[model samples]
Target: MTDLHTHILPFTDDGATDFDDALDMAEMAAENGTEIIAATPHFNIPGIQSRSVSEIKDTFEQMKNKIEKNKIDISFVLGMEIFASPTVGEKLDCGELITLNGTRYPLIEFGFSEKKDFIFSVMDDLISRSYTPILAHPERYDCFISDLQSLYELYQMGVVIQINKGSILGRFGRRVQRTADAILCHRLAAVAASDAHSPITRTPDLSEFVRVLDMNYGDGCSPLLLEENPKRILRNEDVFWESPIPFDYQR
Candidate 1:
């Protein structure tokens, strides 16, 4: 399995504290059947100054070296979970941020309480600039939880949906868990990721979610979310999704 989202680069963001912690997270991921991970640190929050692209690359290189030294058999690539803003297109244009595995797919997130229009506007701008924005963990946002139809609209607009594994496991909350399940049940989610922050709280482990998906959704669910779709994104190829059932909001 390839984890497309993670905060594993040390000193880059609120992820790993140091080199050792990053190595520990990688080891955990390798043990749990994850073969590749994108070291996607948070970028461009309101009060937080994110590390520059050069800085992130430097940190990723250091982590790569340590992983090799420790014999952890997982590959790391560079990415950023960019916070959506008006200037995001400009940033991408100027090479201030990066996409997943240097593909045209860039993972982006909206504020938890951001309204649909604001989110859509940012996504539209990104799309206009020829970047396919992958919405990160939409189940955690109140706007989508309040009105899931908005999420479907985004999906129809060609934006990829990625749900966090922790959300499915109820680590975030019951609301997020329900939303994640709804998204999965409807076949709307294009990928699932660890979204792991550290070695402890949000560790890099996809095994439990895979088991749950296989047991509940079917044997085919895990491979589609965990492997096929994510690999397509990494290769900048189009992702073929299952036909989505409508989200039963009354439930």
Candidate 2:
């Protein structure tokens, strides 16, 4: 499996605390069958000092070297979970922010309570700039929960929806799980990731989620969510998913 979103960069953001923690998180991911992980630390978050692009690259490289020394046997991609803002498009255009593995897909997040129209506008701007924005953990957002039709429209507008594993495993509670399930059930999500933050909690373990998906959704869920689609995403290739089933079938 390939985990497209993760915060394993030591001393970066609110993710793994130090070198030891990052190492452990990587091992946990490997043991749980994750073959690839993107080291996406939080960036451009308001009121928080974000690491410079050069520094982010340096830290990512250092972590990779450590993983290689420890022989954990996992691959890494350099990326940033760029927080959504008015200037996000400009920053990305000027190469201040990076995409997953330097591909055209940028992993982006927004305030949970942010207005619906604003989110769409930001996404539209990015798409207009010839970049596809991957909306992170949409199930946890209040605006999306109240307006499923907007999410459908974003999907129609070429936004890639990413659902977090924690939401699927019910770690964020029933409401989040229900919404996550809706995205999955409707075939709206293009990928799933650990969005793992630490080794102790919100760890980068994916096996259990895979089990649940297979048990509940069917055997075919694994290849789509964990393997083929994510792999294609990394390669910047076209992804394949079923046409999302409409919530109201009669509509």
Candidate 3:
């Protein structure tokens, strides 16, 4: 499986602290059947510190070398979990921020709070510049969780929704877990990612979550969420999405 969002890069953001933690994270990822991983560290948050592109690349290379030396069979790709901000367009134009597969698709995130008009405007700005924006873990957004119609509107506005694996399995919290279910039931989420941080507490793993999806939805649903959709993002190809599952708010 290919995991599109992860924090395995060492000494970057709130992920692994050093090389040892990184290797351990890789081992956990490998054990979970992740063949390719995109090392997406947090970038451009208001107070959260992160590594620059050059610095993140260096750390990724170091991890690659270590993996090669240890004979670990996992491929790593470079990406950034960009926080939605006013300067996002400028950053992309100046080549300061990295997009998925160096293409027009960017994985953007917002804090778990109320929504505002500017957030949608930023997404519009990206689309106006011919960039496809994928909202990371949209199920975790406090504002969208209670209002499926708003998320549907965003989907109509050309935003792809990504659900965190932890959220799917209720690892984040009950509220997030409920929203994650709603996303799946409504076919609102187009992709699923590990969003792993470390080896232990926030380790990089996808097996358990995949199992849950398969058990609840069916075998085909797992690949659609975990593999096929993610591959489209990595290749910058247009996504062929499934129809939204009707909202079952009774749950």
Expressed as tens digits, the lDDT of each residue in 9-36 for candidate 2 is 9877999999899999999999989999
User: What is the per-residue lDDT of model 1 for residues 1-251, given as tens digits with 9 covering 90 to 100?
Assistant: 99999999889888989888888899999999999889989998989977678888887888888899889998888889999889998989889978898899999998999988999998999889998899999999998988887888888888999999899999989999999988988889989999999999999988898999889788998898889998999999998767887655643
Return the clash pairs for model 2, or none. Answer: none
Question: Which candidate model has the greater TM-score, 1 or 3?
Answer: 1
Q: Candidate 3 residues 52-95, lDDT tens each?
A: 78887888788889988988888878888999998898799888
Q: Per-prediction count of colliding residue pairs? A: 0, 0, 1
TM-score ranking, high to low: 2, 1, 3
**Which stretches in model 2 have alpha-carbon errors above 4 Å?**
248-251
Candidate 3 — worst ten consecutive residues by lDDT sum?
A: 242-251
- Model 3 residue 126 CA deviation in Å: 1.1
Candidate 2 residue 202 Cα shift, in angstroms, is 0.2
Cand. 2 Cα-lDDT: 0.90
Clashing pairs in 3: 186-245
Total clashes in model 1, counting residue pairs 3 or more apart in sequence or in different chains: 0
